[model samples]
Target: MNLTLKIWRQKNANDKGKMVDYKVNDISPDMSFLEMLDVLNEQLINKDEEPVAFDHDCREGICGMCSLYINGEAHGPDRGITTCQLHMRMFKDGDTIYIEPFRAKAFPVVKDLIVDRSSFDRIQHAGGFISVNTSGNTIDANAIPVNKHDADKAFEAATCIGCGACVATCKNSSAMLFVGAKVSQFALLPQGQIEATDRVLNMVKQMDEEGFGNCTNTGACEVECPKGISLENIARMNTEYLKASLKG
Candidate 1:
């Protein structure tokens, strides 16, 4: 297959960025999206041109680092798939693909297709963890008898990989789904109960401080999320936030 890639290129954060055109020929449908980009970059290198800069790690789609906006979608046209998991077979020959970095105020473009996502780490650091004693053998694994339903829900919430696709797809650039997923993961588990209120409050506060917009219930975040984090997690966070506000 052959493709015309209109990729965003910026020398730096302050540099004016624009979509630059390039062509890739004889791409294998079996190649992963990142692999196709690799081929393109190799071609650019041989021609002595600066290659496109994008993020990728564990191309198996577990790392969630492969952030790209392909053809105006958060992770391309496919549903519930990350860029690393996307394949060339999804596109036809002679297709014109527009590639851009994950767009959001908090995720400013660093250069080309790369954006600084450290803001997500700052928000996670704010309250995405439980303060448990690291003493050896503090409690048995079976000490907490959590309901099966809650355990499953917590596990589902924990599947969130913090990819920021939710923000990119959301009209408001909301991180609520991501934040709610993290909060719900612990809130549903017994070990997370100790710092439940503080966890939710602090994370939500930090999310706001990060300049992430409000959740408008557009469902775009949930739909674009690679992990399929449910909107119910947002509801849970709201309930928790209400209770925390009332209790204080």
Candidate 2:
């Protein structure tokens, strides 16, 4: 296959970025999207031109480090998959693909396809964990009986990989869905109840402080989420926040 790639390029965070076009030929349909990029980089290196920089690690799609805005979609035209998992076969021969970094105020561009996602780490630090005794008096987690349905839902919410696709896809750049998933992961479990009130409050507070926009119920975040995290988590988070506010 012959393809034209219009990819964003920026030297540094402060540099104004622009799209640059390049062509790749004889690309195998079996190659993953990142593999195709590798071919492009090889061509650039042989020509003595700088290679396009993009974020990718664990191309298996579990790490969620491969974030890209392809053809105006968060993770390309495919559904429920990260950019790394995207296959070259999804595109046709001679197709022109537009690739850009995930854009959001909280996710400022760092380079060509890399962005500062440490904002997510800060939000996680705010309250994405549970307190556990470490002095050899810890209770067995398996001993605590959890409702089957709640356990399933909690696992689903915990699948969120902290990818910024939700923020990029949202028109308002709202992070409510991401925060909600993080909150729900703990809210449904018995171990998390101890910090329930503080968890929701602190996480939501941190999300806002990071310059993320408000959620207007557009539901685009869930649609673009690679994990298919449900909107019900957002509703659950809102309820948790309300209860926490009332208790305070």
What lDDT score belongs to each candidate, Candidate 1 first? 0.92, 0.94
Q: Which stretches of candidate 2 lie over 4 Å from their true place?
A: none
RMSD of candidate 1 to the truth, in angstroms, is 1.0
C-alpha lDDT (0 to 100) for residue 101 of candidate 2: 95
Candidate 1 residue-wise lDDT, 85-191, digit = tens: 99999999999999999999989999899889888898789889987766884666478799999999999999999989999999998999999999999999989
**Whose lDDT is greatest here?**
2
Candidate 2 structure, TM-score to reference: 0.98
Span of 10 residues, lowest total lDDT, candidate 2: 131-140
**How does model 1 fare in lDDT?**
0.92
